[model samples]
Target chain A: MHELTTTRNNYQIDPVLTVWGWEIPVYLFLGGMVAGMMIISGYFLFKGRQKEPTCSCFYVPWVSLILLSLGMFSLFLDLSHKVYVWRLYTTFKIASPMSWGAWILILVYPVIIANIFIRLPKFVTDKFPGLEKYSKMLTDRPRLIQNIGVANMILGALLGMYTGVLLSSLGARPLWNTSILWLLFLVSGLSGAAAFVHMVAKNIYERELLAKADNGFLTFEIFVIGLMFIGLATSTEVHQEAAQMLLSGSFAPVFWVFVVGIGIIIPLIIQLFAVNHKIQHTPVAPIMVIAGGLILRFVIVNAGQVSHYLNAHF
Target chain B: MARFAMVIDTKKCVGCMDCVVACKTENNVPEGYNRDWITQEAFGNFPNIQLEIRSERCNHCENSPCVSSCPTGASHYHDIGGVVLVNHDECIGCKACVASCPYDARFIHPDGYADKCTFCIHRVEKGDKPACVSVCPTNCMYFGDLEDPNSDVSKLLKSRKWHTLHPEAGTNPHVFYLT
Candidate 1:
């Protein structure tokens, strides 16, 4: 009863901008968080201040491995040829940032895994049974793990800054070609790590200790967020367009609702108002901090990817 | 010693995508992928319309960003001829070159190495024209050695005004388009 209508294809589609996608930003966030966790754990270990061995020594490495694995997997998934991904290491083009990142991941992952193995309770217990009781006794002593912590810190810092430098080196993408992007990434990474640790600590530690760490992480997050914003705002037009996309363009709602609202504002306010007077045992602050950190990565990744190179306006 | 280059006349191009199809077929370009393409910019939405067409591929720049961004040294510009090629064995499928390229020309091949228009170096080495040049129905595309003053390309360069895309990138691209 109805005449079939074949619609003419009037609109032409430009080749989609396919360079950096959700993976790059997410990788940056994950790498930064790992670096942050390593630094925090390393600092605490070196100080011999073992407030909670399970949280710092055990959980940090485990989480780092998990995040690292996930980040690397995301990178591979984004590759057009997933099967030959290993060839990237051998290709060794000095001009390519992706090649550098691949090599860095190869080196960093092994070191982090080894560090985790050394701290695992079972490994320590089985390898040196004689030191078991002494090791348990030494858990609370911050001085015992200080060296490991320092190593972690150094490694973590490199991991954090690499994400920023990687993007900045692409001068063609005016949006990412800036030195400040590195600093912003570094600071945000540390904040994300602190938030992660605070969350983990909340679940493992007693109320009082959890509250203190949450407060510390929340304050640190606010400071870093401010720095990131300032860095983004001061950049050149190309970078400004990227920032504007987050602030008001297609990426605005997610940027504001998730990155700024849930990731920064909500967690900050909860820590400042709702939990400030509460006893240290509450789980809310830590949970909020973790939620905010993840959301921050999501919004940033999406925002950075929405712009195109072909547009005259860009 | 062999410096490869291409000159395209914008006026002669009819937006028929002959070069695109020819390059794809010659190079065995995978389905849903393109190594060379024609871009058309049409003005005046309705009734009164004018269109400008551009044929684009890897410019084989002197300062190729794809080469520098590849961590594995898989992508490199040949020092002798300045033709960019990928060393497939060394590439790790990282896509760094793809991101760094301003023209969006390089792509990850199915084998995991970066791939782009090599200016048909294989055919050139055999003293034959590139597939696109030989097949172009309108004779819109020109290829030759830029170094030899007697070459047709060199003669064209001397006589015609031409421009390269994203000259601000400082890549010193070999491909020139005459308006």
Candidate 2:
């Protein structure tokens, strides 16, 4: 009997793709974090919370803008042909997730910049009086700020969902083929953002309110994750094997210990109690939620790449 | 329009690396990499075992995921034979094509572009067979337009019981292997 011994076959990295690395996960985490910030801050802005002295809605657009650019930078670094990156925008293939992401990110900048000018610091406007027109235009029209808020909400959801869609579109990678993956990533972003708002907001009332919201998001995020795994587990044998990697394979350790256990459940329980006033709020739980979001991205991207069609017994 | 496809006879294949070597030399494929490879599989236990060998590369599927997933339109079907080809100048090397390929046939070249079997279109255009089909000592390979009823590949596929890899993928791959 001839042994095909493909274990020695090392072509194009490996039979399993390692084409993507830390760059992808880092970009996804930052992109999701910023996407969450946009929605949370936009909701408050739409509600006119910007009028409050210490409302997070006023400054987070600025932070979101910075984080999103950094996320794009990491994505840029992943491109093997950096100079041809402009070609992505030259044509819009409606079916391609990367095309959708490229256009969405471009649109995000203008919306975020306009949002920042809504409550421009007086000193900066005073220094650059010519730039004051933006503040005048939006501040003069209360409806436009609300419209900006609406735009942010829609775009934020698209950005968050697209992060997962990027991976999900590759049906060859069985682990990421579920439609619910987009919703899972979006809900995770929302939960992480709520935790951030709860931890950073200066107003005690707003902090308490955001902590409650974080718990709701966390609960929902857990449900969505369950739906994703169930969808995978019930899929074709190829997909079932892919799901097994995270469920019981080598990835089980990280997926269970870091992502489900410490990253989600423990922080979720702590935040629930803190919101209920049973425990004083410490930075620990919120920090864990944020770090958990990061770890989740790493696990998903890495495990998804390792999962392939060949492992299926036909 | 001519639709190019390749047909290989697995029963006669000796698990030789000739096709892999010829492709590297003809395409100037980077060192330590190849566009084609040999796969040998055996079924049942030692005494009653049966072996199957295949020389494989890009299937150039009619419904190719690489072309559809490409954000830049860099991976496209050549108008000549609907053969899949990548434009190095336009490819951003995002690896979306690499990841989406069900067969894992494409790879990123060291020069930072998606690379795969072209079925040796350069030679086919010059009225010569693919480097692999030409170099095979056993004459186990055939290449021609499958659309033409009179072509060698078309006739061979018609007469012999053949199978394509990953039929479940629904890619409608052009490459076929005769049992």
TM per candidate, chain B: 0.91, 0.97
Please give me the DockQ of candidate 1 compared with the native complex. 0.42
Off by over 4 Å in 1: A1-14, A18-26, A50-55, A88-94, A109-119, A127-145, A202-237, A278-281, B42-51, B110-113
Per-prediction DockQ scores? 0.42, 0.60
Candidate 2 regions exceeding 4 Å error are A1-4, A7-12
Question: All candidates' TM-scores?
Answer: 0.82, 0.97
Clashing pairs in 2: none
For candidate 2, the TM-score is: 0.97
In order, the Cα lDDT scores of the candidates are: 0.67, 0.87
* CAPRI tier of model 2: medium
